[model samples]
Target chain A: MHEHIQPVALEKAYRLLNHGPTVLVSSHHDGVDNVMAAAWACALDFAPPKLTVVLDKATKTRELIEKSGRFVIQVPTVKLLRLTHEVGTRSLANEPSKLQDTGVELLHLAGDTLPFVAGCSGWLECRLVPEPHNQATYDLFIGEVVAAWADDRVFYDGHWHFETAGREWGSIHHIAGGHFYAIGEQMSARPKRGG
Target chain B: MHEHIQPVALEKAYRLLNHGPTVLVSSHHDGVDNVMAAAWACALDFAPPKLTVVLDKATKTRELIEKSGRFVIQVPTVKLLRLTHEVGTRSLANEPSKLQDTGVELLHLAGDTLPFVAGCSGWLECRLVPEPHNQATYDLFIGEVVAAWADDRVFYDGHWHFETAGREWGSIHHIAGGHFYAIGEQMSARPKRGG
Candidate 1:
């Protein structure tokens, strides 16, 4: 499949996460790469567009990310819903190689040599900000977007267009008990006037 | 309004965040309390029901939470949508008290002294699990749910019945520019057969 990488103004980078979709954290080290599904990520700051993600102490993705100093978060499409669950619960620690177990397709975008899940709608390639305290105590990793890209067909001009896409492009919000909530019913609220 | 506080098993607490709704962080210090809206809150654990939230250093709510060692996360209903944006951008640090500016009705649940915003669908009252490193570096706070309660009118048996009698009890998921999405459309996918 073909792809394009757009330069999202650092200030606008927060828009990627403002919607709160469960994402796959992808990392590469020593020519090996892996992706793990994470439902615990949020926009931590604007202007510079920073994000904080929780990488568990036991996950191989965290180890690889620490060694490589870079990781990419891919917003998985609806078609990969089951795959998201597979990656989230399976431990890379248990299996030396997860890519061998989970059959999820992979894609490489932009300057991100790290491989991303093929069915994702957007990708944020991040460089680790090295918050040792947050990482050790809270499993929180802060990153600054080095490069960002999205499937323009779905996300463009700062708005996620889920109407045109099929489940393969629909974002997944995972609830517990193996259930997930697809981004549903769109509505916009104007800012309340003059408090 | 009549309300009930039911105990939710710790393992299932992630359901509170599964839909990704913006929340009001309420805290009290020496009898002075404050509430602020946070669009960036997410689940960090399942078994222990840990949560990760960002509390700006400049905010009074943060100070109170640090001093009091507790805070409550209240998931507001669609009815409270009008007041969501008001608390987020306006800091209690400037105003003498947030309660005055927000005009949001507050109720103190039994067993927990922190105020919870009435009309909200659920409430998670947590004790600060201080990680000084994470706090000093990223302004990220981690809390373990010591007590949790939900308005059963909306949540029961592990799912939100917004379409039923609790129609207006849907949780508010905010995107950007004040545009919010009420938790819509719920689907259940049974876990695939045993490996």
Candidate 2:
């Protein structure tokens, strides 16, 4: 694991994905690991944090996740935009060594062998919450976050510290095709009245 | 509806929510209408577009949606940040007239009494796909896009045209505690290999 990576409290795990950036979903099973881009992931619950991500039925990542019952979601920074786009467009089944081709280093965490993308801003280790009907009907998988981590430079204390972390560390949001938008200026607003 | 609002192709409706912006979910039932801010929303499928959004069981918006079996998701721009934050914090159940207090105008569509939030970048009219288990267990609602529309200034021809659209028109992404990041600069990349 990266030295800068710090553990995030399970209750605050949703903060990692709350801003809605595109993420890389990594899964390992039977000595095979695969990573793919998923823009359709979002936090579903707060405590005992749960998330939902759409995985195409044909993707290798989906197969690995189904078999292993676990997966990791990594929030790729702007610096990894090109690599994210590259991995998103190619499949591990067709290019068996696509991860190597993309030059993305995988880091083995202290306790788990499941590898996480090294340079990401945050990581969410998850255990699949089986929903066969949803999976077969909509290709949606729900995962309960088992553990979470974030690089302290950009995210710490359950809040994104991106204002001073620099633009290169900001997360990427895919628009369409190969186009993406770097998360921009942060602003604060006050409610007009109390509920 | 606003004169500038134009119909979006049903097949490409997913693009509106693909980038993952905080949206205003509006539903009407029993002569009462309500809108609330939901950040936990994302595209669940591509064709015959589907979306999933989290609405806490306590919310009146959830009740209205369950009774009416329909809702409209409006993508608020930077201009609506304050209103978005205000609506999110205030609930119709408490205020009863919260919408009027927020100063957000509602526009009536040609053939439906369901109101759409004016001044938003895109609008998705949806019919709920009843998933009893998911809804009861996770407070999650799934809806299929029945009609879609977008502001020509920010979206056109099935793609987000935010590059030419001014900053005020860019979508708003909620971080936490009233903080938001306006959708920013667009960048494109090429995949290293084909799928």
Candidate 3:
């Protein structure tokens, strides 16, 4: 685990995905692990924090997730854009060890065997919620977050503090092809009275 | 409809919500109309574009969506953040004429009677895909994008061209409380070679 990583409160886990950054889904099953990039993921609930992510029917990650019923969502930083795009474009079924091909390292959390992509700003370890209809129909999987962690350099105290983390720490929001936008320019709005 | 608004290809419609900006869901039923803010929404499919959004069962927007089976998703710019946050905090059930109270104008698309929030960057007119079990169990709603439009000034040729739209035109990404981050800083990555 990275030295800056720390446990995120379960209640506040949704914050990790609230901004809608492109995430890398990591799954391990039967001694085989695979990672794939996904932009179609978001927070689905607040308190017993839950999230939904799309894993296309043909992807190896989807197969691994189904068999193991576990996956990790890793929010890649701007610095990892190349690796993110690489993993997104190539399939593990085609490359067989795609993570190794991209030169992206996988790190295991303390006392946990599941693999998480290195150099990510946040990690959400999720257990599949078993909505078979949704999975079969829409390629969507809903998961209840069992544990969450974040790199304190960019996230802490239930908020993303990227302003001080330097440009490389900003999260990536993919557009299409290899294009992406780095999460930027924080602002706040005041609610009107009685609103 | 704004003169600058033009049709967006259904195949590229997912780009509207791909980055995960906060959305204003407007619906009309039995001569009554309502709009609500949703932060939990994302693209679910590509070809026949589909998206999912969470509307708590208690929300009037949910009731309107259920009754009408139709709704419009408006991607609000940073300038509309206050109004977005306002509608999100107040329920139309309590205020009755909440849209009028917020001072946000509603404009009708030429051939459609449905109401769409003006001053937004993109609009997606959708018809609900009934998933009773999902709706009841998770407050989740799925909609297939039937028609879509975008402000040519901000989006054209199937991509969000926010760079030239000025700061106020950037889409807003909501965080907890009233804070938001304006979508910012475009970048691209190079795809690595195959394994």
TM-score for each of the candidates:
0.88, 0.96, 0.96
User: Model-by-model lDDT, in order?
Assistant: 0.77, 0.90, 0.90
How close is chain B to the truth by TM-score, in each candidate?
0.90, 0.95, 0.95
Give the per-residue lDDT of model 2 (tens digit) for B1-195.
Answer: 467799999888988998889999999998998999999999998788999999998899999999999999989999999999999999988898899999979886636778799999999999999999999999999999999999888898779978788889989889788988888788777644765
Q: TM-score for chain A of every candidate model?
A: 0.90, 0.95, 0.95
Kindly give the stretch of ten consecutive residues in candidate 3 chain B with the minimal lDDT sum: B186-195
The count of residue-pair clashes in candidate 1 stands at 0
Give the CAPRI rating of model 1: medium
Model 1 lDDT at residue B36: 86
- Residue pairs in candidate 2 whose N, alpha carbon or C atoms collide under 3 angstroms: none
Off by over 4 Å in 2: A191-195, B191-195
Model 1 clash pairs are none
Q: Name the lDDT of candidate 3.
A: 0.90
